[model samples]
Target: MNIQDKLSPTAKEIPPSGIRKFFDLVVATEGVISLGVGEPDFITPWHIRESSIHSLEKGITSYTSNAGLLELREEISKYLETGFSLKYSPQNELMVTVGASEAIDIALRALVSSGDEVLVVEPAYVSYSPCVILAGGTPVSVPTFQKDDFKLMPDALESKITAKTKAIIMCFPNNPTGAIMEKEDLEKIAKIIDKHDLIVISDEVYAELTYGKRHVSIASLPGMKDRTINIGGLSKSFAMTGWRIGYVAAHPEIIGAMLKIHQYTILCAPIMGQVAALEAMKNGHNEMKKMIEQYDQRRRLIVKGFQEMGLSCHTPKGAFYAFPSIQATGYDDHVFAEELLKETKVAVVPGSVFGEGGKGFIRCSYATSYSKISEALERIEKFVTPRLNGTCDKVI
Candidate 1:
């Protein structure tokens, strides 16, 4: 009578999230400065919080339609059109989801079947390959490198295509790496997708957090509107992660298929979250700008700190992370992260958890306060300096 004997193989096979494990370690350790989690440190904007409060005050805590509150969906449609020049019909082509995470899950489930292959660009968010496996698809890693700023090249993608390749799961303003694809880069990838007749799941959760240039949705590219599933939410952009609201925009056929799954699994996103999201769309722009400005400053500080410490750090143009190579320390990613945590009481995610290509790197989040980031940098510098100088066999 073993419970494990009856579990689904996929469910049993799935590994625990590496991010959560490090997060837990940080929580358990005393006096640790964590640059691990990718969540924004800012609270939800006042107006957005007020909207959710007002909704609760009015006794409006109930489920909306399975597709979500029509008002919210309409707002999402308008947000996309105004921001990215992408158009989606609120009625048939868009559905509110629990989070961008859920949208990704349902999109993969809807598009992939047994023996189907989903091209997952690495180093990607931890969820991508697991969700693909859960959906009965084989995840084929198309690795991108640090030298190239981790941008997914058309040649790399083209080489992986086979008749079984159904879709590509792409995340720009990528987690861990913080790499973003320019319009020209995406256009090239889009051309390859068009030629191969493959679909794309564009996870743009960090779209609004880009620094220098604006984010360009692949769905907005020529001939790409119908072939891409656009996923986004208020989590990264508006610091509303706890609100748990996200949405998906795709062609009617795909939306309709995803809706079938959503209806049964999650009838609707929380009504209060929808209200908060609606407020975020209408009034949170100014607040978001302020937060972005702060994140940009922190981004520069962290990347520069790592570079000055002998780590080859990439300047992230989007997202609040810096993936710095720890190769000079002569330690693999996991060892470096663990030793740094133990010795310096600083928590950062090991890049190896992201993908194989991430082995020599470490992902440091700059989403915390500026003062904390500066302090953490000082601490990290102290820890890695001796190792780089070859004066200490162990970094403590």
Candidate 2:
């Protein structure tokens, strides 16, 4: 029997995450200062972790309801309303997922059918297109450019639509670029969405991390609440990545379909994680604010560092990434990333892995410590300065 023949074609066709490839590479190499992965370097807040520990101490080990602990669902509902002015019923319209990642997967699985096309904003999270493919849908890339601060233009979105377009998956305070859409910008896209009658899977995992302006949920727009699936989690905001807790809010019909899939596939999110998430919703804001402040400082530092080194970099409005163009180095993204890692022992992700519009850039994460970010910047400068100055010798 050929083992390869027994696997689903889609599962086989799914490529490994390019981010993970570099992440693993950094792990294998000693003394490398990595700014590649998007994960926050902070430990989970003490109060949230304590809540989970208390739950486990009480032997609350059994599964909750399929949709999750009703208390958690209620907290999520309240959080969404308070944070983004979106209301969802805990009983029928909300679900606790293992993470925003799972929320995204089940949303696509629930909404898309074979032969359907789902519009994905390019330079997108690495998981979106693959998850759409896994759900048996065609993943259509709707490109957004650096010149636009990576915002998805209404015209660009409208151009990707067809009768077969079932939905769109969008991440705001986007990964790799950290681009955020303001309220008016969202209104424009929301109008286009309404005109096309398209469903939106709005992944606002970084909603709390926006700087300078608040994140506007497209679902909050008039007539959009019914058609959008809102996804978010405790990972980025509460520094709870290991907890794997997230949720989806939508119309009860859509939630019911997603719940059915969640029931069969996940049964319930981990009880401890759900407990942590509930605490996060209720009291994690203070800790999140402190972390976000530090990230903002580092974001400015890294962006300035790249600019001083003669790399064209956009100031990220949210999230913890700095995307700088390496086009002047006469290297494609992969070559630049690999050469930087080899020469400086400083790892960053090549932009090509993110999709079409990312080819000339590289993503450096500012989620690590400020000192490490500064050191990495110095190392990168040392490595790139000679090349930028048209010299071939090492200065140090």
Candidate 3:
């Protein structure tokens, strides 16, 4: 019997994560400094961890409501209002998910049907396209470039829409590129979304991590609230990734559909995680701000280091990753990334895996320590300089 023939075609078509491909290599190689993973280097704060521990001690372990714990959802509601001026009803319009990842998955599945097409903004997070594919929808790339600061343009967006287009997935404070769409920038795209009558999945996992500008959710803009599915988490901002707590907010009917899938697949996010997340939402601000400050310092450091090494890097406005162009070294993104790992034991992801316009660039995460980032930059510079000098720079 052919096991390949027995498998779902969608599962076979999905590619493994480009980020994880290098991350796995880092794990296998000894003494590699990983700028590959996007996870924060910070531990969960004591108060948040203690709250969860205390809950466990009090025997508070049980399955939450299919939508998650009411108190946590209410706190999340307040968080949305305070942070983004966006309002969501905890009673019907919200759900606690496994991660922002699962929220993305279920939202796509809820909106996309066979023959439907979903617009994925590119140099995007690797998961969005695959998630659309798994939902039995066509994944269309709407490429954003470095010239535009990686922000999606209104013309670029509207051009991708067709009669079969069902939804668009957007991540601002974006992964890989670290690009953010300001309110005015989002307003243009919002008009196109409205014109097409399409649903939008807005991933704001990096909402609190911005440097100079406050994050403006497209959902907060006029007429966008009901058409948007907002996905968020305590993972990146609050350093609670391992806890697997995230939420989705949308129109009650849309959320009800996601919860139906959530009920069967994941009955609820863990109770301990919900309790810890509540503490983070309520009191984790100071700790989170401190982490953001350090990330800011690291972001500047990494960007400067790239420029010093003769690679062009856009200073990321938010999030902990830097997307640097390696075109100067005369090597494609994959070649540069692979040889950098093999020669310098410094791991970074090739940007090509992120979809259209990602070629000739790489993503370096600044979420690690200042000392490690410094050392990695040194290694990367040494690795690339000779290549720039027209030596057999590829020779390591």
Candidate 4:
């Protein structure tokens, strides 16, 4: 049997995520402190967890409506309206998915036809390119620079557009980089999108984790709601990754199309997750506030620690990751990450794993306890200082 022939070309061609490979290595080793994966260490809030248990106790364990439990969607609608100032009808404009992962996949599958191009700003979340490719769309990576604080510039986006360009995946409060697109920046992208009439798959999964400012959805911009599919989840903001609940709010037509694919593929998001998400919508704001405050303090400490060690770090405005430049260490990102794990026993992801413009940086997630971060910092300083001073021949 020709197994290779049976595999889809896209599946065969897509490389494994670089971040996961290093993570596998680190996880297998003893005594390695990981800041590699972008996940909050906190447990899902007690009330949300209790809601799921309550649902199960009530025998509400069956499959939900294809579009999700209507009640959950209604709660989500109200939550989005209250939190992000975005409004949409729960009945027609929303669909719950297994997670933001599925929301991303469904949106791309619905909007992108064969050979259509979807622009992704790099260093992006790992899933965007593969999701676009799997949908038979070409992933056009627009490299955003550190000097620009990784913001997506309108001119850069405009230059990448072609007749085949169908959509743009906007990842703000971004993973690995922690850069959030401010309102003015979002307005610039909105202007470009308006000119091209391009659809937007806005991933706002990290919206609630912003440091000092409120997260502004691109969908909130003028003329954007109709063209934007807002993707969000309970994963980052509410520490609900294992709960596996996510949703999309878009124009009814787009939501309908995504719902069709989701119906056939996923049927419904987990019943328990839906119940939990509904509870989260009702009572998670205060929890989000507390977690954000903790993350803000850790965000500052980690950024400061990296700077104090003479590594230049982008002071992240959102998310709990710090992307620090490794150029001063005289090692490429992969080499630095590998050596750091082996020598210091502290694991972080190489930025290049995210995409271009990440070659000389590494992403350190500050989602763990402050003590863990402090220990990691100590090991990092010991490992890096000698390397920078030329006392160490090589990192490993």
lDDT tens digits, residues 271-301, model 3? 9999999999999999999999999999999
lDDT for residue 391 in candidate 3, whole number 0-100: 80
1-396: candidate 4 lDDT, tens digit per residue: 999999988799899988789789987999888899888989998989998998889999898899999998999888899889999999999989999999999999999889899999888888899989899889999888788888888778999999999999978988878998999989988988999989999999998888778899999988999999999999998999888899999999999999899988989998999999988888888998898889988898999999999999878998889999988878888999988898889999988888887888999999998999999999999989988898878642
Angstrom error of the Cα, residue 142, model 1: value is: 0.6
- TM-scores vs. true structure, each candidate: 0.98, 0.97, 0.98, 0.97
- The C-alpha lDDT values of all candidates are 0.93, 0.92, 0.93, 0.90
Give candidate 4 misplaced runs (Cα > 4 Å): none
Q: Look at candidate 1 and tell me the lDDT of residue 206.
A: 95
Q: What does the lDDT read for residue 274 in candidate 3? A: 95
Per-prediction CA RMSD (Å): 1.3, 2.1, 1.2, 1.3
lDDT of 1 at 157: 93
Q: Whole-model lDDT for model 2 versus the true structure?
A: 0.92
